[model samples]
Target: MELGLAGRRALVTGAGKGIGRSTVQALCAAGVRVVAVSRTQADLDSLVSECSGVEPVCVDLADWEATERALSSVGPVDLLVNNAGVALLQPFLEVTKEAYDMSFDVNLRAVIQVSQIVAKSMIARGVPGAIVNVSSQASQRALANHGVYCSTKGALDMLTKVMALELGPHKIRVNAVNPTVVMTLMGKANWSDPQKAKVLLDRIPLGKFAEVENVVDAILFLLSDRSGMTTGSALPVEGGFLAT
Candidate 1:
């Protein structure tokens, strides 16, 4: 089905690589102009070379003030994807204040800052926008050595609902995509262990992990007119991992 996204504009955070990069490519393919934000200039350069009509902005979201300044130039967009996140895995007992702060700042706080800025613009411009937050199954379920990461994701999930509720009056839709082990370059490196992969595969009733495309498709649908009424929902692209 046509996504009805042609001529629309979108801003995708963490667009340098992995799922974020794929989302930018998919949006461009759907005929949308994208503003891709990341921390790496080289990756942004590569993205601009690969995709047309893309504007790349390099900003480390960890710095609150800098994130605000960098995103101010983006103007109002039809879609926003808060996909940048950091997962410094450590046992609950071993998690330090620095690790906890880093996870919360990057995963949850940055999302609030970016979404607020974008949503304010959309409301002011009278544009009915869509926002898709990239969360994880780990948010809803506990994972070993993922204490800080999981906590941040869980908080993000709650934030998604609140944003949806408040933004709905402004005709802005907000939702989240919770994905299981997606097969991105980083994911491959992290889950390359055969035994670990099998253990995860067994938990998924579909007997497989997710791909970047799967999550991208879900997000595009949410951003498109197709999901015009979807809001405050967390759509899982987990391949039945949460079912078992």
Candidate 2:
């Protein structure tokens, strides 16, 4: 089915690598002009070389003022993917203010700021847009040593609902994709421990972890007209980890 996404302009955060990079490629494949945002200039440059119709914007989402200023120049976008996030593993008892702040700043606050800027533009131009936040399975599940990361994601899930409620009248949809352990470079390195990998995989009924493409597909569905009626929902692409 045609997703009715042709000619639409989209902005994807964390677009340099992993699921974010895949999402940008998928959007381009669907005939969407994409604005890719990441802090690394090299990654952005590489992405532009690899994909057509992608405009790169290098801005650290952790910096509120800089992000706001950078986004101001992006003009208008019909879709926004709040995918830039950092996961810092810290036990609940050992979590520090610095770590907590960083997690929330990137994962939760950046989503809010970016969505706000994009939604404002959408509303101003009377363009009904879609916003998909890249959340994690850790949001709904309590994972040990992921206190700060989990909390930020949980807040993001809630933020999605609130955004949906407020933006519905304007025809701007908001949703989230919560994925299980995806085999990105970081994921491969972290889950390389057989014992650790087995422990996590046991919880997933599929007996495996997720791939970047899996999450990208889910995100595309949410952004496309195919999921027109979907909003304020956390679509889990977690291989049934949440099910069991």
Candidate 3:
């Protein structure tokens, strides 16, 4: 239960709100010092105010150079949570190059870049750290209009395995948490609309979407020493959606 997380330094992207915000709070509660990154200064400030052990860093993960520079300033991260992502829903024919590029940039490429930067620091310091990528049920199950988002997350799931193999030599573990629809602001704004919410919830065996806490708890488990043997695995917190 201790999680043995005291004094550990964590970096969580997309920490401004929703699941990222909850993750920052959860890590802080476990006595970990968190460097929270997001594009919004105000939201980051608010998160810092609400969470005692969090240090807010406002850097857009989509901006590769800026993210690397900002991360360089905060060296030696023990845990890296690649939680920042974006989803744009559209028919395959309607999906433009810009949308596809944005999805890849934020959801897939950003994870790869940030993990490389943070993992290097961990390896250089000879620290056995953990990296948890926030994947989705979409990574495994395809939805009608989720082509672009699903593809990016599917790629991320694969990246998790490859990173685990590459980083294991340095004692850095890489894993992923694939959750079904979580009741975050993004979920509310997009899927929680009256008709859409009903349709979405129907697919879940639990007959409800996941709470932010559910995803946060899974992430913390992967980050902790309790899951020391866990690497290159996609742990599903899917409310049994995958089972059904």
lDDT per residue for candidate 1 within 1-244, as digits (tens), equals 9899999999999999999999999999989999999999999999999997899999999999999899887876999999999889888889899998888999999999999899999988998999999999998989999999988989989999999999999999999999999999999998999998998888999988898999999999999989998999999999888888
For each candidate, the alpha-carbon lDDT, in order, equals 0.94, 0.94, 0.90
lDDT for position 145 in model 1: 93
lDDT of 3 by residue, 93-192 (tens): 7999999989999999999899888988887788899999999999999888889999999999999999999999999999999998898887777775
User: Least lDDT summed over 10 consecutive residues: which range in candidate 2?
Assistant: 1-10
Q: Itemize residue pairs with steric clashes in candidate 2.
A: none
The global Cα lDDT (0 to 1) of model 2 is 0.94
The TM-score that candidate 3 achieves is 0.96
TM-score of 2: 0.98
Q: Tell me how candidate 3 scores on lDDT.
A: 0.90
Cα displacement (Å) at residue 71, model 2: 0.8
After superposing candidate 2 on the true structure, give the runs of residues whose Cα lies further than 4 Å from its correct spot. Answer: none
- What 10-residue stretch in candidate 1 is worst by lDDT? 67-76
TM-score, cand. 1 vs. native:
0.98
* Per-candidate TM-score against the hidden true structure: 0.98, 0.98, 0.96
Which has the better lDDT: candidate 2, or candidate 3?
A: 2
